[model samples]
Target: MSSEIRQLEPKQLWNKFADLNAVPRPSKKEERVIKFMKDFGVGLGLETIEDEVGNVIIKKPATLGMEDRKTIVMQSHLDMVHQKNNDTVFDFDTQGIDMYVDGDWVRANGTTLGADNGLGVATIMAILECTDIVHPAIEALFTIDEETGMTGAMGLKGGLLNGEILLNLDTEEDDEIGVGCAGGIDVTAIRSYDQEETPESKIGYKIVVKGLQGGHSGMQIHEGLGNANKIMNRLLFDGFENFGLRISEIDGGSLRNAVPRESNAIVAIDAIQEEAFILEINDLANDIKTEYKTMEPDMVIEVSETETPDQIMDLGVQEGLTRAIYAALNGVYRMSADIPNLVETSNNIARVIVKDGHVKIGCLTRSSVETSKWDLANMLRATFELTGCEVEFGGDYPGWKPNMDSDILKVMVPLYKNLNNGETPHVAACHAGLECGILGTNYPEMDMISFGPNIKGAHSPDERAQISSAQKYWTYVLEILKNIPKK
Candidate 1:
């Protein structure tokens, strides 16, 4: 965290953001942040409750002359996706984010900025602290583990809050008002295999793929960005088929929600094919870079000599695994029929690991349509199952269906236009997984809408927040709070 960011306009929100970012809040490991929020609420002398599942709820009575307005629920998840560049040396669990000002944006040094929901969390904190900001009764709900599985939202029990309207401040685009979002499920395939001794004449080499602009798997799926796992498998498949390559180890990608940016593998090939192998692999690597020249200018692939391993995977299993990976899907599966240019279904083959005689392939599949989601999940299951792996599905959550006539949508559309010099906001649905959908499972009657500042390259080290947009978004938040409909 930097003092420079705390000096940004709207110090109320930026200051809170700096304070919050100073504490480590990685997804599924939010114990420190949970306690921080509870302490903040307790310090303010507000009624705060920590739910059984680790969600924090702070209640504030209506401001003067606004008691008749409906109590509004302001929600933002507490945890953030943890991602860093391969060479960055920092512990996410132990240290605060190292952020700096980069012209119009605030970015971290080779690590994710946690702007996806941290900014939203800061907005509520500012409101809860400000005395002059007008508003109705407030229910500030901070859920944890949104990036991994939305476990906090899923575990929320019904009848916890009495608010009639919900405002989710997790949308990434400042000019867009989110009315719905895609649902998601986690798909993992696992198996163990036999290891065999390497041949006497085999030579070892390390293949590295990195420098790709990885991003949010769901929101950026249609952008055609390079997936390192997919690219690595392509190169491996080529080596095995043409040069008699044998795989000893592979490790790629990190979180299931982030597009894989790098992959590294150890492989062995017959000694006689050394010259031809180097030439072909370099040529193939160049071909991949050229193919993604426009979308991934920074993409890089490297191959180097390394010590040969004593053992490698059995030939039969290696063949099956490579083929299975090639057959699996990595990007968009279907486009929305109702909304123009909206992605209806997609998959991100996020993690691939082959080590210690065990193989694990992790994926996150998302879709707005229920049937289409399963259609893609089963398709992936079949592909891995064919390779003698057992597949499991978990973290199932439903999509937030668009409510074109939502009361909050009607209120914010014109408010946004007025704030932006008559520029009407883009009212639409998104492909990202938002907690609004999971929260709806327990609160179906609450009308909801999501909007936030301009945050780009989320779930990756390139993640940053635009300074100007945060100011604009903060103004809109104040207006919406003051204009809540009467109960």
Candidate 2:
């Protein structure tokens, strides 16, 4: 363990998080982490099972006389979003995360800290390793590919878990308890284009927009953060309409669940119009900076000369793609009428790629209301279809409806108040997707609630987890387990 994390209180939890940091476990590529987890469980002499879909379940019988208590399942995903600064040279597949203590929080050096779920996983590991804490029969369920897709949760068979209560350790806020979460689906649009030779009289330039604080698309959609793909398209569309620019290639964003932080494009323009086009781009960049100055203080736009390309996108295809992307919905569409400050429906234009003879655009839509979810999907489909592109939707997951009368909530609420001297914890639903929803489909009878230590800037390089909250959260979990109602 690193000296920095070794000094934090709750050494058990931080030590486990440090160990996880030394292993590369990006979403959809968790083979190493899976083996590490299995080894950790077996080393503790616990019964461990790895399902066909890569989900790991470690069962620890109740301590002493607590066997009659209802079985409680503690759940967290085993993967982290792989993101880094454009200049950072780390590879998620080969390099472990570099973690450090920043004042009251733990963060990475120019990369994601993976604390969104790492802290939760560490907490579970700590509980399993400690024999001194009193608890009911316990099952630690770790799912895979949660950031990119809920494949493990979706493929988990019914009756795989014998638990009657599920405690999801994936929520971000320390003081809030998540009882429900939005369902989500991904939309992809693809269009084929012909290549046209670049005119000899045209000059090539690379235009870039970067430094935006990209975060979890669903969690930070309402924060007014600039979307790099949208911002880049706006500039491209303006250049296409006013300066007669032709695009050779464009790429932005990497993951569908993360807001795009940076985008760059190679475009050509008639040499005669180059000076005026540069001026116009500068003007637009300044206006955008002024508009988002508060939210994106470090946002940068750069236009630099580049070597000419052999071919460019067909004029018609370039125009159509620019128009479609500019018109696509990319932010919160509605807010919940019942839950104050909860997003009801939203969409994120997550990524764009211009490849060989084609361009693909990806989006993610989330909503707590099932009908509203599909309504947004149709809206995106119609928007893209109007631009003569083929659109498809899949990877849909159901929402976990909130149960105010839930047995776990009934026990946790009062217990939390007593633990904190009558400070009532906030109960709410998250806009982001949680594995609890998919797990609920397989085990409809399980009562579920989610809570975690404070984490900020999830899915981004700036991600960090609060130090003090981890200790309090660990204590809370232990107390909750001790108070579980007997069967």
Candidate 3:
């Protein structure tokens, strides 16, 4: 056993986490992690089961003197969003996450730490394996493919979960209990174009945007971070007018739910204007960066030489892509008038790709209200249609509606306040999607509330969880577990 894998508090739980991290468990590729979890439960003599969709459930009998307590379900997703820096070469399917301790916090080197839900998993595993902590009959529910789609949660049938109370351990802010979350839908646009060889008189230049703090679109949308794709498109449109260049290829952003931190484009320009064009772009980059420096101080725009200057997009194709991109919706569409701090609707132009004569654009639209979601989708679809491109809306999950008088909230808020020295924890709705939304529809009677430690930069490389907050969260969670009411 590696020293890094040595057990921490709740050895069985952290051991399972360390062991699970050793295996690759990116979304849709969580078989090894799933199997390992089930086997771990079996070795501990607990009842374990796997659903057809790869979700896992482990049931542990009530601890001594707790059989009379109501059964509580602890839930978190097993799959993680696989992301890494451009300089890193680790593979998600083959490489274990390189984790290390920084003072009091634990994080992965150059990648997502997976502490998002892994902590929840470890906590649940600890409770089940201890045969010690006095608590209710517990069910540890692990769902799969939650990052890309809530397939596991969506497919859950009635009676799968026997627990009447659920504690969701996926919120980022430690002191804020997530009572609701925005529903979301994926929107994609595609346009087919004929290719044409570039005229020999043209020059090629690579336009690059770098050094922005891209974060989870839902969590950080209101943070004022720059979207690389949007900024790049703005520059490209400006360049085309001045230099009469044809875009050969443009690509940016990694995930549909993350803010784009960097982007690059290949353009063919008139050989005579190449030098002047590069200079102009460099200047524009700095100007744009200055404009957004309060939020994106690290932003850099560079126009550099490329190996070949011969490749070029067809004139009409270039126009279609540029127009569609310029017109596509990006940034917060609406702010909540009711909730002072809430963002009611927003869209992130999350990904852009050019391949096989097709340039595809991907965006994720979010809204707490169903009408707002559809309204944003309609705006995107209309923008694409205006550019003569085809657009499609992916299947969307419903939002978790906030119930102020919810039974779960009634129980958790008091526990939270008492644990924090009479500090009343904030009650807020998340713009991000949570399993509660899907689980509500699947199991009508289930009541859910999400709470967790203070985790920053979720879904991005800068992600980190606060040490003090974790201890507080654990303390509060334990209290909630012991006091949940029975029917």
* Candidate 1 per-residue C-alpha lDDT over 96-158 given as tens digits, one digit per residue, 9 for 90 to 100: 988899999999999999898999999999999999999999999999999999999999999
Q: Model 3: per-residue lDDT, tens digit, 1-487?
A: 2245444443454565676678788888899989978997898898899998999999987777778877888999988878787667888889887887666666778888777777777777777777557788888899998888889899887787889878888998887998899899999988877777778887778888987888889989988899999999989898998989778888899888889988988887788997888788878887898899999887888887775545566677778778888887788899887777898899999998864478889999999989999999999999887877789999598999887887878988888878778889899998988999899997777778898887787787777656666767777877887787865
Supply the TM-score for candidate 2. 0.99
* Candidate 3: residue 124 Cα off by (Å): 1.3
TM-score of 1: 0.99
Clashes of 3: 0
Rank order (by lDDT, best first): 1, 2, 3
Worst 10 residues of 3 by lDDT: 1-10
- Weakest lDDT window of 10 consecutive positions for candidate 2: 1-10
**Comparing candidate 1 with candidate 3, which one achieves the higher TM-score?**
1
**Residue 68, candidate 2: alpha-carbon lDDT:** 91
